[model samples]
Target: MLAALALGVKDLVGSTGFSGEMLLGLIAAGYAGTDFIEGFMEKVPLPGAGAGAVAGPGSTGSGVAVLPDQSGNGAAAKVAAQMEANLASQLNAQTSQLQADIASLKSTAAAGSPETSWALLTGPSAASLTPDLVARLFVPATPRANIRTHLPNVLAGLRSCDLIDRDMLLMALATIRAETEGFVPIDEFVSPYNTDQVAFDKYEPGTSTAVKLGNIEPGDGARFKGRGFIQLTGRDNYTRIGSQIGVDLVGNPTLANDSILAGRILAQFLANNEDPIRIALADGNLKVARRLVNGGSHGFDRFKDAYDKGLRLIPEGVEI
Candidate 1:
């Protein structure tokens, strides 16, 4: 059936060239109509988004094939999402295999071991993220100061998760830097053990923000108020992120304060948000990026100011 479909598409497209893998993918994706397939092929065709991608390159504006989601759905969109997830699982499995293979290869190579070192495993970002860069990226006398000290470790966590591109790193920093107030506050705003209460100590379990963030019960408000650099708020978030990162964020909500763990969470969050965030970045729409991150235009001016300032600090030799 796939062979026949491929033949038909080929005949219909005439001069258009389609790869066997792509054709098989479209068939598997359950896409119908030659015209739809033709139009999709002409546009950015993302059959499977390639190996569980959280961060992607190219851009929708660039016509380099952005992963279509709610805005660009059909048989192709569904196919792409499924393909991405399946590919991601396959890639992780393949990553372990590749790591072992690289280990074997490194034994023969002059460098010794590539997989053992982050510089070898990570892309250009390994060199880009440094103390000096962090120093430059950080706003003068802001809260995100600790990020400079903790950057090397954060970069390592990013490398482990295979999210080490200039754009992605910058985007991550932009969003996180904005939310964490210069990376100053590792935990949420409200604290149960605080000796002195301030004006904005709003979280109290049944408050509006607290309820929206999934905080219930007596201490649930303070427990999952908002942790992590980007503020992973609410009980739902702690439980979900905990499961994703292999950390007991629910049981030990304080774990979100840990730099490396929090960094991982941040990377995951950025990775998962392809639409609007990555899509906006690809479109050169930084404002949209901020909007998507903030979930609205709230405090956008400050966020944009920080993002622009942060970009100046990225240094040369890297392209986001």
Candidate 2:
């Protein structure tokens, strides 16, 4: 009987992830005698019972009756409650110590591995990303249906560029949210905010912006205008990214709007400037990170919002 009681206590402590000294102590107490075990068990309050409540005949505190001890009489209730209080205190201390030990182990492992430390700060691998998890990364204003629809292509895009890290994935998602809150590739809006003229005359041949964009002909600005998840703008970008992805973006610039192609383009663009973006992010400079892709703080607010949301919602080092 004593051995069986000790084994039962061992199983209970083991199930709670409480081990080492606590387990040994409980087993040792159990081996002392069955009377000791019975006394300890009697003090453990029933589930949902008040801390001061004691089990006794005709009492419904725990929806069950516990016969009072033959000896000790009324004093049994007081003694039992006090013993329970003491046991609760001990259990709480054990739990806190176990949690601290687990945290220390995690910190030590992270210190031993820089990659693990990065993962701890950023999040888990992109391969483990799910639609439910992605939904949490966006604000309530963004439609859930849109996130569900585009999630497959988004994962594909990340995989295409070998962007397995959660941080990189968040950066890509944040950029998409900034550029197109609708979660669809779109043509750049013709406004003073986007262009100097409604006709996009600012990017006409011989102009400085036009020269930088490789827009040598008329209508080149509007033709090679921003499109895709990250706004693959300008003739030079279309030519360069298209060549890398094996698409004739220079001839059919609008193809950047295609869901699959757009995702690929977005990932490729980020991969191209990954170094500068990481540097800025490491310094907690979201503005510089956005500038690396957008050339300015065009969508800084949206970008920061999405990225910050991701950092909060996505659990570190936890695969979803």
Candidate 3:
């Protein structure tokens, strides 16, 4: 045993490079026994020692390297936790900045987009008519109050009938300007051409005028007198137009005086004759266009004046 112990001491001293005093001490420990050698080894500091390692003999518990502890509450563990926290904070900050950047890009895109810019300029419907445009189209003597009161209904009528074309719109507007100078839907005056007793005798029941107008019933001429924006007249016209528009104009001809109904009646009438009117206007034949609507040149001058003014004022290819 003593021989083996001596050999182990020599090997330990040689491997550890212990000099003079340390080598002597190791030899003395080997002589003391295996237990003493083990105790001595436990007290000796090793390079790259792990955490929870016992302090070497004569160690000051400082300036010694240690591995990170697996257990909680150690210095190494605290440092690891602090590093993780810092990394998490930095990641969170970066994530927030990325989100903000994405939001700013979306906002910028929407603001600068062509569609959005056009929408802002043209409004929701891109309608051509405005109070300013209407005022400019009408003569100075035309009543502003009447235009304001009736223009909305007129626009609705034109739009409803799909009369958004520049020429069609001008023709309709001119018709209104000529038909009702005040832009009001009104009952016809007792003129010789309409309901005058002496002049309207030819329009009595069974007469040619009455037969032409389908005025088979007594008092039909007076009952179905000119009304609405276009002055819808005659029982035949009322029946046909009312059926086309799904209104009971034959039973209640007075409904035509309603501004909304009047506007619709006027637009529908124009739509019925749209083909010929468009052709005439295309050919610059205002007289034929006026005749198609009025059956004669009754309001040709006024219609021509209003149409010319509208062409000058309103831009071509304007949409509703």
| Residue pairs in candidate 3 whose N, alpha carbon or C atoms collide under 3 angstroms | none
Tens-place lDDT per residue, model 1, 1-320, is 43334335444233446533234434433333343345434444354434244244433432444443444437446755675676566555644553454343333233322212223333356456555445444454664447666665566656766776666777776666677756643665444432136422354454676565676666676677667777777787888878888989999998887888877887776666745576787787888887665656655655665555455445444532
Against the reference, the lDDT scores of all candidates come to: 0.58, 0.71, 0.70
1 or 3, which is superior by lDDT?
3
**What RMSD value applies to candidate 1?**
26.4
- State residue 243's C-alpha deviation in candidate 3, in Å: 0.9
Rank by lDDT, descending?
Answer: 2, 3, 1
Query: Can you write out model 3's per-residue Cα lDDT over 178-228, one digit (the tens) per residue?
Result: 788878899877776764455355566877778877888887877887898
Deviating ranges (above 4 Å) for candidate 1: 1-128, 142-145, 182-185, 190-208, 310-320
Candidates 1 and 2 compared by TM-score, better number: 2
Could you say which candidate leads in lDDT?
2
Poorest 10 consecutive residues by lDDT, candidate 3: 112-121
* Candidate 1: worst-modelled 10 consecutive residues by lDDT: 108-117
- Expressed as tens digits, the lDDT of each residue in 8-95 for candidate 2 is 5444344447533234434433444444445445656567664235455546554434445557566657656666678788666655
- lDDT comparison, 2 vs 3, better candidate: 2
- Model 1 / residue 40 / CA error / Å: 68
TM-score of 2: 0.62
lDDT value, residue 207 of candidate 2: 81
